[model samples]
Target: MQITGVWLPIITPFKDNKLDYQSYKRLIDHYTEKGISGFIPLGTTGECPVLSDYEFEEMIEKTMEYNKNRLPVYIGVGGNCTSQVIKKIKIAEYYEIKGILSVCPYYNRPNQEGIYQHFKSIAEETPLNIIMYNIPYRTGVNMENETIYRLSEINNIAGLKDCSGNIKQTAELLMNPPKDFSILTGEDLLFFLTLTMGGQGGILSSAHLKTEQFVEVYNKIKENDLEAALKLWKPLYDFIPLLFKEPNPAPVKYCLEKLSLIDSDEVRLPLTEISDQLKDKINSIILK
Candidate 1:
C-alpha cells in the first residue's frame, strides 16, 4: 500500500492504570471520520516502552477491531533486539495491519552497517511492509541517507518515518528517493516543509488535535494550492509545539480529555500528566 498522507502516531489512553478500551475505541471512531490517512498505534507516542506484553497485544487487537478496516493501521514494532522485534512483528501480523513502523535500534548505538543489517533482517523475515523510523535524538543513531537508500532497494522495506532532525539529510533523500519508497516526515513541524519537498505525508502526533485541518493541509498541497495550504498550516505550525512542550501523550491526552474525545487524561508513570502550567498554555490554545 502507498504510505502517504497524515497518519496519526496515535496515543494510547489509560484510566486507573489500565488500558481504557472505551476511550481507545472512541478515538478510532473519531479519527476515522476526520480524514486521517491511517492509524499507527503502539508507537512512541503510544507509550510503547512502558506497556506490558498483554497490553501491547490487546492494543493491537483493539486497534484492528475498533478501526474495522476504515483506514490502514501500522503497529510500532522495534527494539534493540532483532529477535524480539521480529517476534512483535509476528504478533502484529495476525491483525489486518498495513505495515510496521520499526525504529533504528536504540541505546546500543550500532554502526551504519549494523543499522542496515538490522532492518534488512526484518525485511527478509516479514512479508509486511517496513517503515524505518530514523529519529536520531531518540534512537541515538541516525540512519543516514546512504544507509536508507541501500535499504530502499528491498521490495517490502517500503518507506521511512523521517525524524533525523537534519534538514540537509532530509533534503538529499527527497531529491532522489527510490521508486515506490515513501518518505513521510515524523517531525510534526516539518510536515509542510517535507510535503513541499516531495515527501509522501506525515506520521504526526500533533494531528490528534486538529484532525480534519491537517488532512486539508495535505490535500491543499497535493492540489498545488500552496496559498490555501499555508493558510491552514500557519495556525497548526503554532499549535503543534505545545503538544510536545511536555513529554508526549501526556499533553496530547490532556487535550483529548478536555475536548471530551477521551474519558481521562491519564498516562503511565515516568510520563506523568502534563504540568498545570503547561495545561494552562494548551487550554488557551485549544479553547481558542
Candidate 2:
C-alpha cells in the first residue's frame, strides 16, 4: 500500500447518544466529492478508543459501503499491546481494508528493541501490507530513523504515517528510505513544508476546507512548480494553528457540525467539544 494523498481521520457522529448512520453517509459523500484519498475511522481524530467494538466495526463497514469503492478506506487498528494490535490487524485483513494505519504503541514506553520487535512480528505474521504510524508525542515512544530503516527492509510493511514533530527525523527518513516506502506527514500545519522537504503527502485534518490544496501542493512539487505551489498554499499556513487550537477533532468536529456536515459537536470523554470563545475565533478565521 503506497499510501499517498489526503486521508481524513473522520469524526464519529452522534444523535440522542446513538451512532448517527444517516449523517455519516452524508459526510462520506461530502468527503469523497472533496477528492479525499481515503477515510480513517477510529483514529485519534475519530475518537475510536471511546467507541465500542460494535460501533468501530459499524463505522468501518458503513464507510466502505457508502464509498462503494470510489475511495479507499483505511482502518486504525492500533493499541498499546502487540497482541491486541495484531487482532485488530486481522480484522482489517478480514474487511479487505485498503491499508492498516497502526500507531506506535502508546503508554507502554517500550524501548527501541521492543518497538522493532512488535512491528517486525506483525509484518511477518501475515501477508497484509501495513503503514507504520509514528506519533511520539501521543504515544510516549518514538521509533527513530534507524529502527524505521530496519523496518523499511520488511517487505510487507509498506509505508509510514510520520506524525513526529521532528523535522530532522522526517527529512532523513525521506532522504534515505526505500523506493516504495511512503512518508505521509500527519501534521496538518506542516503539510506544505513536508511536501517541500520531499515527503509523499499528508494525512491532514485541515484538508477539510479545500482538499485540492494538498493535492495541488503534491502536483506542483511533482511537476517542480515550487513557486506557484508556495504562493497558493501560503494563505493556509496562517489558518492551521487555529484549527488545532484545542485538542484535535474538537475544533474539526466544531467546523463540520456548524458547516452542517454532521449532526452534533459531541466527542467522547478525555476529549471534549470546543468552547464558545474559540468557536468565535474559528469562525472569524473561516470567514476571513
- On the 0 to 100 scale, the lDDT of residue 34 in model 1 is 93
Question: Each model's TM-score, in the order given?
Answer: 0.98, 0.95
RMSD of each: 0.8, 1.5
- Per-residue lDDT of model 1, residues 66-175, tens digit only: 88889998899999999899998998888899899999999999999999999999999999999999999998998999999999999999999999999999999999
Off by over 4 Å in 2: none
* Candidate 1, poorest ten consecutive residues by summed lDDT: 279-288
Model 1 earns a TM-score of 0.98
- Against the unseen true structure, what C-alpha lDDT does each candidate score? 0.93, 0.81
Q: For model 2, give the 10-residue run with minimal summed lDDT.
A: 88-97
What does the lDDT read for residue 171 in candidate 1?
93
Clashing pairs in 2: none
List ranges where model 1 is wrong by over 4 Å.
Answer: none
Please provide, for model 2 over 77-132, each residue's C-alpha lDDT reduced to its tens digit, 9 standing for 90 to 100: 88888987777777667675777778888898999999899999888776777788
